[model samples]
Target: MSALDSWHPDSKDLANLAKERLSQKEAQYILDHCKECRECADKLFETIRSQPIVGERRLVKKQNWMRAATLTFFLAAAILATHWFLEDNSRSGQFAIEPKSLPDLSETIYAEEPSTWFEDAFTHAMVSPDGSKMLHVDSLGVSLVDLSSGEDLRAELLLDFDQVMAATFDGNGRIARFANRRRDMGWFLESGENLRSTAIPLDAVPVWAPGNRDVVWIRPPGNRIVLGEPPDDRWHNIGDRVLGLAWDPTGAAAYGLAMSENGSASVLRVRPLGGEVEIIREGLDASALPNGLAVAPDGQSLFISLATEDEPDADARHETRVNRDLDIYELEIKSGALRLISNIEGDDFWPWVAGDYLYWTHNEYDASVMLIPLGNPGAKPLFDVVGERDGRFATQLPRWNPSGELLAYTVGSWRLADWGLNLDTEVVAIGSDGDRGPPAALVTGYHADYTPSWSPDGRWLAYRSRRSPRPVPYYAGPDVTDDIFLRRADDPDAEEIRLTDFGWEVGDPNWSTDGSRLLFDSWDRVPGVSKPWVATIDPEHGDLLDVVPLKLPDEISGSVSGVYSPVSDDVLFIERLNPETQRLWVMLAAGEVEKVIDFTSYTRGGAAWTPDGESIVYSALVGEKMQLFLVPRVGGEPQQLTAEPVNVLHAQISPDGLWIAATRLSQKKEIRRLPLR
Candidate 1:
């Protein structure tokens, strides 16, 4: 056995011996070594004859079949798996940042013919109540549209970097709001005003009531429900940011959904406006009710849409298809009774209730809107215009008008999805079943776009735009700039206007409380060097040229990620102490730098301020892996949110601030959420 184990074909001198015809010198050397080494000599000869020769009938039959069998098995396996092994190994190879190719078109030409360089990757959209205006926000800026004609109204700068937050329309469809930093909210009302705003003793994300009367907001720790006031202070918190939150039609009650450590569904807490006696519902998995409450006209019961991940798939390749259906539930506020209304599948998310209809989106490989009648037996498909409503390579974020008669959604694309494809995005109108038609292409770009918010009246829409980076060589590499834009929803005769030209890159545009102003930030150029700069724009003129650079410390540019306050319009960004040690910093809407709080010392970048603007959630590198960390903006220790070894990048705050959605790396890239405590 030892001799057989020791035998290796490479060790054989048989080739030399055959070539030299058993030369005396070589033969002598082999014999000498063999005499001293019993294993090599015993196994060498036997292993050689195992080839099953038919010619040269020399009567020498050597024997080590064990070694030959073992070697042959391994070789066969290697050959059989060669293609698979090569493909697998090839995917594992290091990914490098290659230089980007810059488009040769002039910036003006690109401005006039937006899609000349960008294909429609617009992902999310919002339409005004009157259906005249619409908005789209993306990696670029805020875009307003005139729905009557496919014309750009205004393109305003929203963020200086990538936006990871969801945009929602106010109940009246008159204002559009998005989460900025903690305690901050960006809102745009009917007046087309742009502002970075917040209320005193700020709340979490500001969610509007179904009637658009009061904004349902969150207050941390002791999650309290406050009524919406002027400067906007109706804040509430549901403990964890990952919890599900929903508002009743009357804006009277707020529901919180959670899953316990045991994987059992739990109704963490429920708060009714004005009267505060928290209600708890237990015995459930995770609920799909992020802003899920839509009160019945009688006010006797609450209708909510609930969803839960069924179970892990048997095959890992099918993981993307894991969370499929939504279990629509009806819950009674006074009796604490719960009943399943219907079992609907196809990735139902962010359901909006309008009159007798429950409107929600179903992502079946492709995401589209569907309306189900509460009084009827079935649901109706509003449109199959995903590619036309969205873009060729699209991601969906839809918002409906107060009446639910009209709907608007945002669309954007991934880098790989549009790698070689040409596309465009449109804010479509679906009056009823089979009424879907080609959407009004509001924004155009060579790269990607998203984030659509509609006014309460459905007459106006606000959106953001981002041009893909065009590489210009620098230091043996290349530089890229992703720009921001905005347009009007109603003025289809108008053209989109470029917002920020600083070139540091921009994203995530939000409207102020009254919609008279828009607030967003700009990221400075340089990989480990960036800073947030706030700007003001004239929504009607689509003038982004009035940007006034926000003041910051010299170190602000050392390393930063762009962001803004969801409530107050304050510009929020992350500053780093080198590539690690990220700090959450905020600037007032007036271009004044305020506080700089050291959040996490993680050896990584990328931080998102929670909807409330009290704490910032960021990504941290743990060991050789990256995870999510939540740090207070007031300066405190950081809390690790995720324990996975996978890398989490570009984390986004949900509209209600209960969930931290992020891009997770698996076999391919996937979006996941982490609950905040």
Candidate 2:
């Protein structure tokens, strides 16, 4: 072969060179040779055309061969620039591009169609009080689905909020109360209506009364109960340190779970319209954490959802741990006597009473709607609602219409472990100085992209993405198996190239300093067993070069975390010795491993090495909250960086050392209503 002909660049390398990611000299040499070589020029043109193009471009006149070739090169460069612009603009605003709202599939699917219920991991559902319509909420916005029409009842009232926390329909189903983390708003369910919102104090839980016209919510700091109306209404305090609330059927009285200074809890009843508060039951030894409450139809008893203490080895890094023992109890209003009602194996809460039945949600690996006759507490659930796929399905917030003919609840494939991955998460870029301009989304669609690692040159990003068809099971924990994807840091619209797809759990991807190898941890052939490995790949053709398994200590078997050092040929990783303890280890590129930092407490992965590789930044659970800490690579006392209440899941130091890009867990769940048979 001729000397010039032999120097052919692969598709990936050629695209990088076209985008100017290569050194100036390297890029110029390729361009110089392509100008005179027809074969190389044709190859380059085909590569550029194969990539995802944003918009259609008219071809230049081919009458002049040289001019056409030059125009082609410039056109490719322009396409890359356009992709970056669109990506940057989509994520710059208060919210990501208004998610293309989900369409009502009920219209297309017949009622008798088996397995017709649409399933989503991030959506919530709740039936209206009257049961004629249903309210569906998700990360994109709030949707009111009509049962009879199988369409959105109020399309104009579909409030597209970024993160919706709680949503409820009033007794008349005319007004709805919805709260995200920042604020709570009242939505009139009529057509073409706007939202009426009010600022909620911190740590306060907002609840709607039976009338739906009045809202009873707790005020933060002191936990004072307040009742107010919509549109800048006044709030009146009724009780103090209330942990939970429930309104009576008559709407004249409301009951609450109150906590004492010494950690004891009690139930109190009060009138929202300025009346004396009565202690229904005091000195109850129940745990301070109460999830939900509901008053008996006859006003003789109260149903409360309480959680037992979590196991010592439970991983708190997740939004909600698996197998969190929760149950519902019945308390006699007059005698203060309590009895367990439902004790299924799962995280069960959100109890709702309708007629003679008590309904609640059971959340294990999947979520299901469970119900039992109040008169027969010892009997099993009359029926459990689930999706047809047999995958990880969840059904929560069960509500019955006034007639009780149709049951409505929200169903999805996501469980508690999938919370942070599915909703309100975006790979945001901030300056090293913490000047967060407009955060850009790393990827868009139904799938989630997380744990982003910048390439050594800062021109590309490698992250783990959950785009597979199979749903992650609940017992598997939050560490899900995903395919590794790579995309240009600047080109948002460019198609992401998939690297690894063995169907094994993979995460914490770290790029080598030379940008030719990727270091990550993956589960072995056995379930629940994980090991660290390094893979050399050709980014130019998106081909895997070789896989090198690191020699791990015998004690380290269940799960391990690894990252490539930003400046050296070494890899830093954390290996769990047991459920409660883990140790930091370092390994050379050749597979030799050495223990570095011994950690007795809970430490999560996603640790980042400092630019100089002398220190590491990671998150550790300190006194119930996950905080950022900086530890020396050689091992010493770690320095705490942030002490806020927010939980930092992943932190990455910028290439320029000006910003720390982190994925913060702010709000986790939202409520919605779906129809059940």
Candidate 3:
């Protein structure tokens, strides 16, 4: 279609415009029409999104380091997260970074990692109140170091204090750490030359008070305040998610913000002596995230940051979801008056109140701390972590010393190589036979792309991708979400067309034998339960008809992925008995339980049926490596495929047995530090 009939551009012409294949005159003519025609404008953008995003994606691997995919693509790799496996899931909590809200980092010096400076940095470092000493934990174990003289004062390797959640110094500069044990989690404090442990909840960071009473703290994964001291420890139900807690100057009571069941919060006052829980303010609109706290130096007001619930994102596929970032606010302690302090574009939380400035870290593509005039919105950035120049390093987790004299944070070389938890992943095609050689990148971009299922005829492919409008770094938040996308299986650099936008995690994508429908599992509307979802599509035009979960026989709750058999009417899937228990089961055509395979699988990219439907192929962690395993339809001991030391994820053999299209991960990481200023 040209400018003769309805003056609309077809998909072919739109592709040329997106790839800059059209001449200046021809392109200008189409642009002039698109400005007036809403349909054509939308088509042009859709075509652009379909093209291969080589600008920020890498298509190759290196023996050690990555070489850029495009000449202009500075970041070739970063992210490989065995570090976040299972317990440290990147998608466990819900947090989102709006792509529109993020600034393009290639043009700026933010989000890039300065891994070089932190190649061998310690994982945890805590500064004392006077800044005279610091408590650090490394492979050698927990040790106290004198920052000035560079002297190792003491070492506590047997204690295993590396994973301290929150450590605060008492008036005597003693550190309280979570004591990791088998039975329960507790806290241990350094009393004189001896270590004393308490039964207080490990997460509730105790504030050392007089009479050996450590009061004030909220329990994690819940909304309860742990008060009193040993023997008579009291757990008070706040009935709200506590955001920030700050102690008054007199230390008589602690003031904190606790978000309610709905999208509102209240300011609370807890007196340790009388166990009095008072609500200073209630029904204040806010988002239950980004915990923050700050008491003015003069003890006049309390500072906090919150995202109001009313400002939901319009373009979001998830309905009734707020997309606003956190902003700072000030509350007068005595008068109970609350006022907005800073309403910036990004997240501003965990405030620090100095003499004339209020310091808080701003969350965006760039990691920065801002210092604004006392209770003022107008502020200037005091320190900025710029690492994109080399794309090898990143710095974050900045904390102020007790005296507010120095800022302490860590720089990491721990680039997940774009293949870890929260990291970017690309759909790569590998040959089943070793003769077919190395894998080739397809549908490359700066988002998490995985779970590829080739069409029956091998003309098209269906996969799940967390493709966002924003440029995702090594770690995209859980709320970023995975959507279904279709691409040409033969064409490695083909345009990718999105199918579904449910705004939650999608998994185990499978293309039907007839290539008419795409089936995958989702945890969208149903949080814990994993239901198989199906969508009909047009292979040529990539038109999505509708998406709905397939109702199978029996209660197959919390299923992993369901794969259709080529020969019979059987579906293979993994059943989740609990968080750690995964059992393999097959359902026949009439919804009959075939056989429960004893093989336990914690598979990723999902299991695939062989071309003949006789054997099942899946990836499993064997000796710390994700290796491919083959199991028979009848069940028994599964056969192992490859034993390569590297990660081999999402492996599936082609129908012709010529190629094995699978995914793998490579990564590097370390830690270091930077000055506050």
State TM-scores per candidate. 0.33, 0.39, 0.43
Query: How many pairs of residues in model 1 come into backbone collision?
Result: 153
Residue 426, candidate 1: C-alpha displacement in angstroms: 9.9
After TM-score superposition, the amount by which residue 547's alpha carbon in candidate 2 deviates from its true location, in angstroms, is 3.9
lDDT of 2 by residue, 1-677 (tens): 77676776677767765444455566667765665465566666655667533234334344444444443544443333333333354322222111111111011111211110112222434455555555554433566677567777653333465444445555545545444424444332323365555454434556666655556677564466666643454554434457677788778777888766433456787776666677886665333333457777667677765443221122221222233345566677777766554444443455555433344444333333333222223433222332222223343323221122223333333333233324212322222222223323444433344435556566666766666333332222234446677777568787777777655567656778788888777774456767777678776654667777766656455446787787788888777676456677676667677666665434353467767888877766666555567788887888876664534434555444433434332222222111211
Worst 10 residues of 2 by lDDT: 101-110
Worst 10 residues of 3 by lDDT: 74-83
lDDT (10s digit) by residue, model 3, range 1-677? 65544668888887776554555577667765764565666666566557643453434456312222221121111011111222233332111111111111111111211111122122234455455555554333455667567577644423554344345554244676665545545677777777777766655655554334446666675587766664676767888778666666556667777765433677788877766688887765544442546666456677766554232221221111123455666666667666554554444455543333344444332221112111123432122222222242332322221122222222222221122222222221122222212222334444545435556666776766666565432233334556888877667677777788877778746766667787788887457778887888876776788888877667566577787776665788777665334666777768677664544333333466766787777666666555567888778788786565444444445454333334332222111111111
Model 3 gets an lDDT of: 0.51
Query: How well does candidate 1 match the true structure, expressed as C-alpha RMSD?
Result: 29.9
Predictions: Cα RMSD each: 29.9, 27.8, 21.3
| Best model number under TM-score | 3
Model 2 lDDT, full chain set: 0.51
Answer with 1 or 3, whichever has the higher lDDT.
3
For model 1, the local distance difference test gives 0.43
TM-score of 3: 0.43
